[model samples]
Target: MAVAPSTAARSIELPAALADWLATHADALDTSPALASEVVPRLAGAGLFGAGVPEALGGSGGDVRDAIEAIAAVAERSLTAAFVFWGHRTFIEYVLQSPNQALRERWLAPLLQGEIGGATGLSNAMKFLSGIESLQITATPLASEQGGWRLDGGLAWITNLRKEGFIAAAAVTSSEGAPPAVIAFRSDAGGTERSADLDLMALRGSNTAAVKLDGVHIGEADVITHDARAWLPAVRPAFLGMQCGMSIGLARASLGAAHRLCTVTRSGLLGRVESLQAELARAVGQMHEGVADGRFKSAAAPLFRLRISLADIVQQAVMLELQGSGGRAYLMNHDRNFARRWREAAFIPIVTPSLTQLQMELQKQAAAAGAA
Candidate 1:
C-alpha cells in the first residue's frame, strides 16, 4: 500500500510577521554575510529557535517533526535562515539527549534563547558513525589532579559558528583506544579557532566555517556521551530527520510555483506536478512515521533512503518550476526567487550524509548481506 502522509504529524507554523520578514529579506540573507550572521538572533526573537524541544528544557514543547516543519516554513522563505536553524536545533537535540544533566542544565536555556549559537560540528562524526570516516579530533587525558582532556584536531566545514558567540559539539577519540567521546565546548574557549566564512555559490551568509581545536580543554561537564558509537545511533534519526526539512521546504516551494504556473498558463505540466507532489507526500509521511514511532532509531537504512528521495524530488521540483515559469524565472528579478531555489537545490545533494554518501552506505549494507 502507498503510505499516506502521517496523520500523527504535528504542524509548526512560523509567525506571520516573521514569515513576512523572511520573505522580504531572503535575498539579502543569502547574499549579505552580515545579514546572514544575524539570522540566529532573529529566529530567537521570533520565538522559533526551540520549536522541537521539550518545554522543560526552555523550549516550546514539540517533537523533532515539529522542528522539521518549522525549518521547512522558514526554508520556503529563506533557505539560508533554515540552514542556521538546523545547525542550532540539532545541537539542542544533542544536549537534550546527553546523559549529563549538568551539561543540559547549564546550556539549554541560553541555547534555546539564542543567546549562544549552537554549531553542530558533527558531519564528520556522522560519517565516522557510519564507518565511512574516522573521528577528526584527538583527545589526551590530563593528569589526575587536573581533570579533563585536551583536544586537537579540526573540522573541514561546520555551520552556525556565529561571531557573537557559539558552542560546538564534536566527537574525539583518544590515543589510548578508548571509545570516541562526544563533547561540547564554547567557540570562545582557549585554543579553539574558527575560520572566516567559506565562500559558496549560495547560502554564503550561513556562517559556515572550519574549526581547529588546539589543546582545547573539555571537562567532564562538557561530555555529551562517553560512548559515541552507541549514543550516535540513538540520535542519528533526529539529526537526519531535521536535515530533511531543508529539502522538504525547498521542494514544496518549487512545486508550488510549478503548479501555480501550470494552472495560470493552462500548461500540460500540471500532471507532472501532481505526480511529484504525491511522491513528496509519501516521502514526508514515511519520515514522519519513522521519527515518531522510533523506527528510524533502530534502523536508519529507511531514513537514508528517504533523505536520498527528498534530495532527488527537490531537484526535480526546482526544474519543474523553472520550466513552468519560462522566461520570467530566467530573468534576474529583484526577488531572485527561481534563481535562489535553483542554487539551493544544488546544495541538497552535497549536504552532509549527502546523497552520494547515503548511496554508498546502502551499497555497503547490500554487499555485507550478500557476503554473509
Candidate 2:
C-alpha cells in the first residue's frame, strides 16, 4: 500500500528577510490598522512583492508556485498582511501576463525593485467576466492625438496605498462592438478619486477602498489588454490560482491554533478538531497538486472546491479553539485570539469566488455536464 503524505508538506519557502519582518510585525499587523504606504516598501524591499514577476523583466525570476508558497506563508501568520500582498501581487501577475512590452519595461523593473507600489482593481472585473456580476468601470476612445483611451468609472474592491501608487484596472468600451480593455492608472493623476477607507471586520488594515475615475487618460504605455474579456481567458487561471494562497494559509493558521490548544480539551472536542485538521490536509494536498502539475485551468473545479473546504475548516478550527481554551474572553474578543481568525474565515464566503457564488457556478457546471 502507498504511504499517505504529510500534512505539513510545503513546496516553496519564503525568503528569510520576509520571514523575519513578518515575525516582528505580525502582532502589530493583527492588532492595529497598519498602513500600506508604510508597510509595502518593507515587504517589497524584502523581495516579498516580486515573486510572480519574471527575471527578464527585472524581477527575481519566480513563478506561480513560488508566489503561492510565499503568499501562504504570510497568510499563515497574518491574514491582513496576506491580503495586502495578494492585491499587490495580482497587479504584478496581470502585467506579467500582458503582451505589452512598453508597459512591462516601464513598470515591471521598478515595481519588482520595490521602488514603487500599486493596487489591483480587477476583482470586480473578474466577477463581471465570470458572469457573477455586471461590469461597472468603463473607458471611452480618446482623440487620435491622445494615443489612448479616457476612463470614467469606479472599482470598489481595489487596494490602494500611496497617493502615487499605480493600479491595474479594467473598463468596458464606450462603443458597442469595441472590446473591453485592462489598463493601468496612476493614483494621483487628474480625474482619479479614492473614497475614504472602508471599515472591515477582519482585514481592516489591508487598505481596501473604492476608486472613482473620471476622464483619467491613458497612453499606449498603460494598456495591458485591448480586449479585457478576451484577456480573461489568458489570465483567469493564474488569477484563480493565486487565491489558493489566501485560503490555505488562513486555514493552516487557524488549524494550527486549534492543535496547540486542544491537547487538554475534552476528547469529543479534540476529535472534532482532528477531523477539521484532516480536511485541511486534503485541501492543502489538492493545492499542491495544482501548483506542481501546472493544471490550474484543468483543475479549476477541484481547486475551487478546496477553497470552499478551507473556509469551512477554518470556521470549525477557530470554534474548536474557543471550545478548548481557558482564556475564553480572548477567544471571543473581536480583535483578540481566535476571534479574529473567525472573522477572517467569514470573509472566505464573500471573497471573489464567494461560497454562494461558487455554489451557483458549480450548479451551473453540473447541469451543463449532465446535459452533455
Candidate 3:
C-alpha cells in the first residue's frame, strides 16, 4: 500500500495501476448496469477489496483506517465502484467480526477473493441500533426443528445485490420476543427475491435493489450474532467510518479538479478551493483519530456529525468544480465528468443514515438530554 505524507489526512493510496483501472472504466460503469455488476470481481482481482481485512481472514492485514482509505482512493476515480466496494468490504467486516467461526470459514474466503459478492442489507439495522427504526425483518422459530428460523419482511433499499450470487446480512426481530439478531441469507435460497435495480438518478451501475423474504429459512450457522443489540454497537464504528470514505474521496477529487481550473482560467476561485480542501483534511484527520482510539465505537454521534460535514464539503466541491469549469462542463462530450461528479455529490446526503436522518437523530438526543 502506498502511504501519503504525514501532513495528509489519510495515509493509504491504491496502486497506480488499480487507480488507472478505476478511472478508465468509471464512465462505462456509470452508464452500463451490465458492466457495473462485474465491478466486485474486477476490483477483487486487483486486490482492492481486502485492505482492512485480516490475513487470517484471507485478507491483506490492516485496520479500519486502511479500509477507509482504500475505499476513498477508489472513490476519487469512481463513486459507483466505491459504492460497490463499500458494500462488499462491509460484508467482509461482518463476517470477520461475527462470532460464528463456521460462518466465517464457510464464506470469508469466497467473499474476500471476490468469487462471490456480499451485500449489506443493514441500513435498517443501523437505524434500529440508533433507536430510529425497528428491525425490518423478522425471524420466527421453526416448530419442526431445533435451530431453524423463518425470515419474513424486506429491505426497501440495499446495494450490491448482484444477480450472480451473494449473501446479505440483515437484522431480525423474533416472534418469540427474543433479543434481535443478525443473520446472513444467500440469494439462491428459496423465497428470497431481489427486485430489478431501482431507477436511480445516479449510480445506475451500483446493483442496488429492494429484497423481500417470504419464508426464507436460516439456521444457527447463518447467525452473525444472536444479540444485534450487542453486536451492532461493537461493529457500528467500522461500519459508518468506512462509509464516510465515499464522501472523502469524492470531495478530494472534486477539490483537485477545482484547483486545476483555478490555476489557469479560474484563479479567482482559488481561495474557495483551498478552504474546502483544508476542511476535508481536518475532517479526515478527526475520523482517523477517532477510529484509532476507539472513540467512534463507544459514541457514533461524532462520526455522524463528521459524515454530515463531509457531505456538505462534497457538495461544495462539486459545485466549485462546476463553477470553475463553467459552460465547458455542461457539454455532453468529454467534459461531462463534472456532471457525473455532481450527481455523485447528490447521493452523499441521501445515503443511508441520510443527512436529514442524522440531523433528526441529533435533535432527538438533545431533547431527551434536556428532559433528563
Candidate 4:
C-alpha cells in the first residue's frame, strides 16, 4: 500500500525553550562554523527539522505557513543556519511524499530526526536552454553486479553538499527510445562525488558545491519522484515557503538596524530613521498576512516579490543607518546588519529561476489571465 501524506496536529505556539535557544544561539550560528554545527543538531533535536513534514511521519504536521513562520524566526537570528535548515526541510518534505517506501524509511526518517543531512543535486544538472538543451544529466542502466542504474553527468551548482548524507537530484534516464526520469541518490553510494566548494557571494555557510555522478548506481528505491512534471508543483511551493522566511529575516534585520541607529544617533536624523522603520513594519505585516492566508500560491509569488523589494529595502535601510550613525555603523568590527542581509537577499533572486525569470513568468501569467 502507498503511504499517505502526513496529517498530524499542528503546533502553532512557539515553545519557550525553542525561543530561548534562538535568542542565545542566533549570533553564534551566523559567525561561527562550530556554532552552526552545534546548532543544526539542536534544531533537529527540537523537532524543527520536521516542521514541514506530515505528522504521521514524525513531523509537527504543520502547513507551509507554519514552516515559513518558524524559519523566519530562525533566520531573524541566523540567516546562514536558517538557509541551510530551510533547504534541508524542503528536500525532506519531498522525500516523505515520494512513492518509494524504502527510500522514505532509509533517508527521509533519519534526515528529519537529524541523524543525517541531505542536499539537492538537481540544480547542477539544470540547463536554461529554451527547449531541448534544458536537461544536462542522464541516467543509464548499469550492467555490473552493483545492480540498479548508473547516473552520468553533473549538476552546475548544488547546496549543502559537504554536509549532506544524501542528494536529491534530477537525471534524464533514457537511451534512444525511452523517456527521461528524475532520480535521487545517497551521497555515500558508489559513483557519486562532490566537487570543491564554490566561492559564493552570500550564504557562505551553505557549503554549496558542484556534484558529479559518473555511472553512479541507483535503484527504484532511489527515485524520489519518477515523474518530474508532477513533482514540480510540490517542490516549487516548498521552495517558495523558504523564500518567504528569507524575506522576513532580511526585513527584520534591516528594521532592527534602523531602530538601533535611531536610538544611538543625534535627534536630527531620528525622523528619517523612524520613517524607514515604519515602511519596514508595513512590509513585514504584509508578508505575515500573505503567508497566513495562503495567498500568493503558498507564499511563492509573494516571497519572490518580497525578495525583489527586500533587496532594495535593505540597501536603503543600510544607507540610512550609516548616515544617521555616521562612521560608527561602518566600523569593521561592528555588526553590519543591513550589509549582511542585503547580500543574502541578493542570492534569493538569482539562485534558480532568477528574478528576471520570475517577473517574465508573472507577466505571462497576467497576460494569460486577461485573455481568459
Candidate 5:
C-alpha cells in the first residue's frame, strides 16, 4: 500500500462534534464494559453510524474506506465499541446494496439514526456458502398461510448484538442446488431465541451471544438480498477489507503502550520495538491502499498476507508492552490497560479468513498455481 497521503487521515476523520466528545470520554470508554444499547444513543448523537450510508438514507455518505477509518478510531479507544460500529455498518451495507428497495426505505433511516443496533451472521454465512463449513443455520420457504420465509437453526455466535435489536442474518436453503440468502429479523421476534452472552476469551465487552431461530418469520420486505452464491464473492472483499482499520488501531494502541514502557525502562530492546513500529506503519499503508483501490478483488493475496501480518504484529506489540511494563501490567487496572490489548490480540486470528484459514487458502492457491 502507498504511504499514507500527507492528508490521508482526513479521509477517516470523525465529525468534529463527535471527536470533541470522544477526547473527553476516551478513558471511561476504554475501561468500562457498558451495554451497547446504553452507548448507541451516544453514537447516534455523534452522527457516527451514518458514515458509509447514502445521504438520501440519512447517512453521511462515504464508502467503506471512510467507514473503516471511523471504526478504527473507535477501536483505538475500545475494540468492543469498534465491533459495534462495524456490525451496524455491515448490516447497513447489506440492506442498502440489496434489490429490496422497500426494505431499505423502511429501516435505513432509523438504523442510521441510532434507534437500532444489530448483529451480523455474515462470517459464518460466508463460510458455509463457500463450503468451508456446513450450514449452521438454514432457510425454508414459507407456507402460503404464514407468508414470507422461515429461518430455522441457530447461528453459532455473533458479536455486537444487543439483547433487543435487529439482526441481519443469512442462510443457505437446505435444497439441492439452491443459493443462499440474506435476510433481516428482529432479535426478539416470535420464535427467535437469544442466548446469554458466551464466556468469550476476548471481546467479552462486545456483547456477543448465540441466536437460535426456530422457524422465525421473515417477510418479503426483510429479504435484504438472496442468491448468496452469487452475492458473497462481490461483498467478501469489502467485508474483510474493512477489518483492517480495527487491526491498525489496535496495533497502534499496543505499540503506544510498548513505547511508554520502553521510555521508562530505556531498554536495549528499543530497536526491536522500533522495527515493529516500522512493520505496522508499512502494513497500515498497504492496507489502506488495497482497500481504497479495491485490490482485494484482484490481488487479494497481498491483502490477506498483510492482514495476517498485522495479527502477528499485534501479538508482538502486546508482548513488548508486557515486557517493558513488567509487574505493573499484572495489576487489575494497569495504567494503560495493557491486559485488554493482550486479550484483543486473540480475536484477529479466529475471525473469518482467520490466520489458519488464510494459510490454508494460500496453500490452495499455491497448488492451483503449480497445476497451471
Candidate 6:
C-alpha cells in the first residue's frame, strides 16, 4: 500500500533526514531486491513520490529540478532504485501534462500512490528507428470491445516490466491517413504476457524483460499522449535528467576507487586518473549547462554528446583503476559494479537517435552555419 501525502504545505527542500536515511540504507538497498523494493515505499513514506504531482491532485507540485535532485541523490547510492524513481516521476509528469484529464485522474493518482508500478514502452519503436530493424510488436484495434484496442506486439529489452502493474506508450497501427498515437494498459490485463527477464550486462537488478502483448485489450482511458511527434520533444529533457544522474554516479564510484588505489600505490598512473577526473568534471558541467539552456531541444542529440563523453571518461577511469590497483581490481566483488557501469555507459550511445546519426546531423548543422 502507498503512504498518504502530507496535509501541510511543505517547501520543496531536499531533507537532510532523508539523505541520511538513504545513506544508512544504501548498502542493503544496493545488495538486496527486497530492500530495493522498499525504495518507492520509503520515498512515498517520506512524501517524495508526490514531488512531481500537482497540488490539486493531492501532491506538493514540485518542479523538474526538485525531481532531479531527489533522483540524483538516490543514484549516488543505488542506481536501480534511482532508475525506478526516475521512471515513476517521468511517467507521472507525462500524465499530469497530458491533455487527457480522464487518463490523469484514473492512472496518475493511483500510480503516485504506489498502487501501480508503470514503465514506458517507447524503446521498442525507438530501437527500430535506430535501425535495429527486427521489431516483433504490433497494435491493432478490436471491433468486439467498445472503444477498445488490441495489441499484439513484443518489445525486447523493456525496463521494469516484471515488477510493474503496467507499461505505457504509443503503438503503431494499420489505420491510414492518421498519425500514430500512444496507448497503454495493465501488464496482466488478460492477454498481455511478459517474457523471461533478459540477462543484461549492466543494470542487472533493474528487472528488464521482453514484453509480449498478445492481443491485449486497451480502452480510450489508456491513451496518455495522442501526438506522436510531440512526445519526444516533451519528454526528452526529463529522460536526459536520469542519464545525467547515472553518469554522475558512475563518475563518483570510479573516483572513489581511484582514490583508494592512490592511497596504497604510488605511481605516474595516478596522474592519468586525476586527468580523467578533471575531464569528467568538465563534461558534467557542460552537460548541466546544455540541460539548463535547453540546447537539447529534441531527439537527444546534444545530450547524446555528453553521454558519449561520460562513457569515454568511465572507460579511461576504469583502465586507470586497474593500473593503479594491479590485478586485484579484476576480482569479483572489487570492481564488478564498476564493470557493469562501464558496460551500461557503452550502451548509451547505441540507443535512439544513435551517436553516429547524431554526429552526421551535427556536421550538417556546423557546415551550414559555416557557409552562412
Model 2, 40: alpha-carbon shift in Å? 1.2
Q: Write candidate 4's Cα lDDT for 1-372 as tens digits.
A: 111133422223445676577656555444444443454566677777777567787777656656766676677666776777776776776676677788888777777766666665544232221122467677777677766676787776766564546465565646543555667776787777877666665565565677777877788888776666545554555565565576566556656766666777656667776776677666655655654455654335565566566555655765665675567666757765545655665565675656666676567667877999
Q: Cα RMSDs of all predictions?
A: 3.1, 4.3, 1.9, 5.4, 3.6, 5.5
- Residues 119-142 of candidate 6 have per-residue lDDT tens digits of 666654444433444345455666
Segments of candidate 2 deviating more than 4 angstroms: 1-34, 266-268, 291-294, 326-335
lDDT, model 5, position 94? 77
Clashing pairs in 1: none
Please tell me which model should have the higher lDDT, number 2 or number 6: 2
Per-candidate local distance difference test = 0.88, 0.69, 0.87, 0.62, 0.71, 0.61
Per-residue lDDT of candidate 5, residues 265-321 (tens digit): 947768878989999888777776776677776665776788788888888888887
TM-score of 5: 0.88
Q: Which stretches of candidate 4 lie over 4 Å from their true place?
A: 1-39, 124-133, 143-147, 171-173, 176-179, 263-324, 336-339, 363-372
Candidate 1 per-residue lDDT, tens place, 1-372, comes to 011133556565677778888888887778778686578888988878677677677777668888888888789889999999999999999999999999998998898788999989889999998889989999999987879999999999999899988999999999788899999978888999999899877898789999999989889999999999999999999999989999999999999989998999838899999999999989998988899889988888899999999999998999899889887886786238888888888999999998999999999988998999
Supply the global lDDT for candidate 2: 0.69
**152: Cα error in model 6, Å:** 2.1
Comparing 2 and 5 by lDDT, which wins?
5
> What pairs collide in candidate 3?
none
Where does candidate 1 have its weakest 10-residue lDDT segment? Answer: 1-10
